[model samples]
Target: MASLNSRVKGAVMGASMTGGWLLADLLLPEPWGDVVLYAAMAVVNVGIGWRLGKFYDKQSDKETAADFDAKKAANYELPS
Candidate 1:
């Protein structure tokens, strides 16, 4: 479930970035426009990548912790 959500989030972010770049290119003028468009794309992509990276990292941590807990529970024994 977490994996699926992460993939969906990544896909949405990619699609939005592409759409935004295209729109910016169309609306803005010549060389300066291209420059701005690329810059904005870079910045946005970096920000989104950073944020999603953290989110996935946290999700992975949660999954690892859950797995560890399950294993610990399964192996638990009564002290004599």
Candidate 2:
């Protein structure tokens, strides 16, 4: 089995997000029939997926979720 590359991961993530939203759009009642909003949502989702892939590229195999939690704790500390 081959490991997935970052670019593929990003593309897959972006496509999946867009596809999921489209599926929802088909099933749900159209409250907001704005095409621009839907387009913007797809762009934002793709951007997030791209960023996630970049983040994955920077990670080391030895890194743990606890390390991520610690980083988050430092960066997003609640106001004292």
The local distance difference test score of each candidate is: 0.86, 0.74
Q: Residue-wise lDDT of candidate 1 within 48-69, one digit each (tens)?
A: 7899799999999999999999
Q: Tell me the deviation in Å of residue 4 in model 1.
A: 14
As a whole number from 0 to 100, the lDDT of residue 58 in candidate 1 is 100
Give per-residue CA lDDT, model 2, range 5-59, as digits (tens): 9789878977887797777677666666446557768788698789878878667
Instruction: Find the 10 residues in a row with the least total lDDT in model 2.
Output: 28-37
Clash count, predicted structure 2: 0
- The list of candidate 1 runs beyond 4 A from truth reads 1-17, 78-80
Model 2's TM-score against the true structure: 0.40
What value does the lDDT take at residue 68 in candidate 1?
97
Scored by TM-score, the top model is 1
Name the Cα RMSD for model 1: 4.5
